[model samples]
Target: MTPTLSEVTVGDELPALTVPVTRADLVRYAGASGDFNPIHWNERFATEVGLPDVIAHGMLTMALAGRIVTEWAGDPGAVARYSVRFTRPVVVPDDGVGTEITVTGKVAAINEDGTVKVTITAKAADQAVLGGAQAHVRLP
Candidate 1:
């Protein structure tokens, strides 16, 4: 159910989400997004480019992180604005398990217009991967 304005409060934390990203996902994203950057699927090229291994697409990570707010609001259209800074690359190894992305969010404020601001943090391997992540969302 969508959260009401009265049910939300500043400093409230949303449930955490962990997603396992695999090499197949990168290939699919590459095909769908036309972002066939070698670094995302080629470990050799990634390491040559100064990256530890194949890294996930920044937009994919952003979308995964945004799931927290969307699921909380129970409506994708309720989101007004979302922003994030790519601070660190999420390194994905060739292992079958690949890597995991963890997302967490906290309510920063309840606006006068029945909107709420949420601060988000995305991490991989216990290291932060996104900075200044926040979302503005409308609630019922």
Candidate 2:
């Protein structure tokens, strides 16, 4: 069930989510998103371009973070507005266990229209990956 307007508070926090990013995951995302940027799949090319390693797509990271909001809202369509800035590249290594991105959200404000503003924080390797992440969600 979705959270009701009365059950939400300004500082209420959503459960944190951690998503793993691997080279294979990036490859699949590249195929689906048509974003075959060399930096996302080609390590040599990425290194030449000054990237520490092959990195996950910015949109992929954003989608993972957005999942938290959608899940908490209990309906994907409940997200009325969402935005974020790609602050850092999520370095995905080619190993058994790749790096993980963590997403956490807090209810920032409750709007008059029954929509709540959710402030999001996404991090990878203990550093912020997305900046100014926010989502507006309508409650049941």
Candidate 3:
């Protein structure tokens, strides 16, 4: 069921989403989003550009965070506005551990139209990935 606007509070926490940042994942995201940035698909280019490895698209990580909120709110269209800062690069690896995105949200303000300004704290594997991630959502 969709959550009512009045049901959310100032310190509500959204469930965490763990996504593996693999080389294949980056390649697929690049194709899907039309963001074939070398840093996200070419290891040699990424290394030449001083990145650790082929990095995942920033938008991909942001989309994961958005999923957390949209799932909690029970409707993707309920999200009126969403934004995040790419504080760190999501490096794709051939093996070993992957990244984890955890989203904790708080109601910053309630609008006259029943929309809520949500302030989200997004982290990746315990590191702050996106600071000041926020969304304006109209709850059912």
Candidate 4:
């Protein structure tokens, strides 16, 4: 169920989420997004670019972080605005297991317009992938 405005408050933390990002997932995302960047799929190119390995797309990491709030609000449309800065890359090795991303969210402020400002932290392999991540969400 969607959370009511009154039920939310500053410092209220949403449930944490974890998602595994695989090479196949990157390929699919590239196909859907028309971002056939070599660094995302080519290990040699990524290495040449100084990246540890093939990395997940920044937008993918942002979307995964947003999922933590959307799931808590129980409605995708409830999110009014979302933004994040790419800080680190999420390395996805060729191993089938892939890399895991962890997202944690908290209510940062309650807005006068029945919306809440949520602060989000996203990490992969103990390194932050997104910086200054926050979402503005409308409540019921």
Indicate the worst ten consecutive residues by lDDT in candidate 3. Answer: 93-102
Candidate 4, residues 1-140: lDDT per residue as tens digits? 56789988799999899999999999999999999999999999999989999999888888888999999989999899999999999999998999999999999999888789999999999989999999999888
lDDT of 1 by residue, 51-102 (tens): 9999999999999899999999999999999999999999889999999999
lDDT of 3: 0.78
**What would the TM-score be for candidate 4 when compared with the true structure?**
0.97
Q: On a 0 to 100 scale, what is the lDDT of residue 69 in model 2?
A: 94
The global Cα lDDT (0 to 1) of model 4 is 0.92
lDDT of 2 by residue, 26-130 (tens): 989999999999999898999999999899999999999999999998999999999999999999887868899999999999999889999999999999999
Segments of candidate 3 deviating more than 4 angstroms:
none
The order by descending TM-score is 2, 1, 4, 3
lDDT of 3 by residue, 1-140 (tens): 56797787766656655555677777788889899888987789999989987777889988877787788788999999999888987677656554556667777888887788888776765777787789999897
Error of 4 at 32 (Å): 0.5
Which scores better on lDDT, 1 or 4? 1
